[model samples]
Target: MNLRQLIDASEGVVKADRVITGGTLVNVCTGEVYPADVAITGDRIAATGDVTAYIGEHTEIVDATGKHLVPGLIDGHLHLECSKLSPTMFADAVVRYGTTSVISGLDQILVVAGVDGVREALREAEQSPMKIFWGAPFKTPYTLPETTVGFNFGPAEHEETQDWADCYGVWETVAEFVLNRDPDVLRALELAHRNRLPVFGCAPMASSTTINALSAAGIRLDHESYTAEEALEKLRAGMYLLIRESSVAHFLNENVKTVTKFGAQSRRVGFCTDDMHVADILREGHLDKLVRMAIQAGVKPIEAIQMATVNCAEMYRIDHLVGSITPGRYADVLIIDSPESFQVERVFSRGVLAAENGRTVTAPAAPERSAALSPAFQVPELAASAIGIAAAGDSAEVLVVEMDRTVPFVRTRLDLTLPVKGGVVRADVAQDALYCTVSERYGKTGATATAMINGFGLRSGAIASSAAPDDNNIVCVGANREDMALAVNHLAAAGGGQIVVENGEIKEFLPLPVAGIVADIVPEEMAAAEDRLEAAARALGCELPSAFGYLIFLEITAIPDYAVTDLGVISYHTQSVVDTVLTSR
Candidate 1:
């Protein structure tokens, strides 16, 4: 690992352990592509030039003669926990697709088990082939009040910055800034700043005034812009832009257009998949998909690779070890047959043959520690009659959350008159409205709020998920209250997971033992289970785009206008629970 030895190897003074001769090396650092020989010693690239003398006895030569050698891909931000698989299984799914590293928003761990849970997950992430970096989550219940399911952690749970940045090799606190000049957020920013950590951003639909304030608060990069104009404005405001393409949002193509419009201003623009599901990754791809999307948007292949590799490493200040194929850098290389298509044929992570022929050659690392049970996963007992909604009289009026198909994140509150029977409100199938409920999962309050939601078009049946974002409460949408209770009860009894029930029978189920959020299964199995659940929802006459993903967001309060929580339905503007009944109507 000495510089003198590497220099000697470059001059044929020493033998290299491995020599990859005659490959078109992609020099992302200089934006150059040329034919060269790369010499590797151990896990570091010893030299990258004509290395005719470096070949000797015991030198392993990788025949890359006509193939393209590029740095392994890097994802700017992700949530492996949400992939519904353990860290080991998640790696097997993405490494074959050529992803070498990622920055994970560990907020999922915080939400399920607080900071202690985060520490445990970080320990397990070390066994993964894909280098996982940590990001300090700013949206815990302490920061965002609606994140409460009565699971509160004091400042003691906040692991010191050194524990994350040094021991766990974390990058920084991601996607946060003061909301309405909140003092707690300001205090959190000061803490991060004191530790010399860079803060990433998440500011969607922010006006000039808010953007300026965010910039001044040191949130330097954003991946939330949905349009080219919005991305350009963020860059103009001295913030880096991450063109995102996730399971729910696809902004890579539009942001590439923004990069083209910038001409020279494209340096600050990059790529990321802030949130993606395992089914989508198994079907489409990982970071590789975003790269292909960029190429389709008229972006040069090398430029897109830069955004996926170097740009992200530079943003996190980890370029010294990764993001390039140069001396002193980890030999994380991808062998592709062509530059035009960027088809990754073979992969190497840290000089290990991690994947070959679209499959991982390296087996998953052994489980370092047993899975710690998160108390948040505990659920209270409930009956089929517990979720019932009592009505004042016949033909009562109520406000329903209307779901919009074809386009996501749009809904209109409709005043609906429903017939009452047995002193309870009933669902109206003719109007495509169903009863949706969010029940407390931590067992603090056996509270359940039932209301009508339009959009699922469920003819008859119920679907329940404990994968609710932020709080991980049980959210169920169904055409019948009895079936809704059955689905929710099933999910609770299984610890925590997703379930689809129809005609008093269970159709699809996937158990998630990790805080009732992540499953102890491989990506293939997880994807298959999710696919079956989607098909089951469709079979039950529920017509909505990807019912699995669409309904999970029902309890997400981070999104727009209206969202349901265990406490009640929340209005983002008022930051309080909105009434379910239309008294005036």
Candidate 2:
């Protein structure tokens, strides 16, 4: 049936603006692969049949010779901010990979910092070819008991959120901080529904009471599951589980026996690359890698695909648009060479050749830099004097916290007695350890906490980074006190960048002029620079936490706890924010 004849026959019933000729359709709805011609009128698919029978002049035709058509791919959950690329660039990069849609969870960190920045991201998102569905960020961000560092929760202005609520009606109810079962947070969830945003909760609350409230309040998705038990409990409680790549990787590596038990229940779960850097994305692939890993770890391919596709679509209530290659769904499909290998031969997004043989066909233009997104770098009063040691005699015994490799928390504390040099406790590099300090970078106060951590491998140097998005005063820490001082100065010298100091001099640096936190450079360049930072840290004898820089955001009260921010070290276990430097040492 030619599309025109079909449209003409259904003229009083259904109409199509365009038609595609001779395409193999993978009907996800029926699990059938058959020959059919597809007709599109505007963005929606109008009809599918043997279109040659009803050809007509008004229809725009695309010859899908020997091509297979499927629905566009959806990224269930992601944080576009960590990509370092603005939303436009991000859309451009992923569209080629067949990602037509993304559920931007917790993305408001980039938007909530400022109204102007939020507007810019939204403007770019609106203009982009790929669909960008945003989740409204709840839970006041970067708000500690005493500090309002980085981007404080700018007032929830209606401009960025109103469209999603009033128009599309998708919203997110995020719970910040250690899940202390705050009823107010539940109230915020109710408010999200009131405002018309479908609520999605951030996982790992300390109390099940909060989880129950969120579930009862109708917040139905979670992405942070540190253990399998937590993942299962949430699923039973009716919250959609968006399992993160790293967390899954960690759990699978531990030889945990329960993954197989949960693998059968994978339908309730979806995949996400929550916080994947661009370099890693280029080298390792995106959610595809997570899918591949799951398959390799004994998950059935059908189940794995469901986690990446149908499950995701159902969770976000976008099943009608994509997730399956049903007759009516948009033709967004990947032509994989082999079902077993999952080697993508070509990709079609929105019925167009977005990627072929392994690269993007169209790239999105970079977003214009907003002055509000960039922070003003403040030269903190950090000198050699600021890096201090507490001791009564010529020798000092210090407690150095040992960080675990697989997790985001410290494992044990190391007690070491070392000689005091020039009235300061000196780091013993021969022992492959050193002193570290976390400074309050918000310019609220000159408060700094000096502590010790092992496994940086540096004998006489320091490395420092920060997540303070506003004042640009980096919360830096180092092994060598003098080198620590030099590192911050080096960062300031470069107008706000990450730096490694060795023996009182700058050893390695990546100039992050954007917000004094994210890189202004391209993803590959930033990845190379990050690699250099890791190499430099390892060369300095650090081996504890390889992704150490990520630690800066953990301490903020709004995110899950056991983290160090510019405010102070917080023990979510005790529900108390503690000093970086302990007096007992």
Q: Which candidate leads the pack in TM-score?
A: 1
lDDT of 1 at 437: 88
Q: Superposing every Cα of model 2 onto the true structure, what RMSD results?
A: 4.8
In candidate 1, how many Å is residue 444 off?
2.3
Tens digit of per-residue lDDT, candidate 2, span 19-113? 66666665545545677777664444556666544356676777666666555656776666555455665665566555667787333344234
Among these predicted structures, which one has the highest lDDT? 1
The candidate 1 region of ten consecutive residues with least summed lDDT is: 168-177
Q: Give each model's clash number.
A: 1, 26
Candidate 1 has a TM-score of 0.92
lDDT of 1 by residue, 453-510 (tens): 8888889999999887667789999987778888888888887899999888888888
Off by over 4 Å in 1: 1-15, 52-56, 142-144, 149-159, 166-177, 261-264, 365-376, 388-390, 410-412
lDDT of 1 at 189: 64
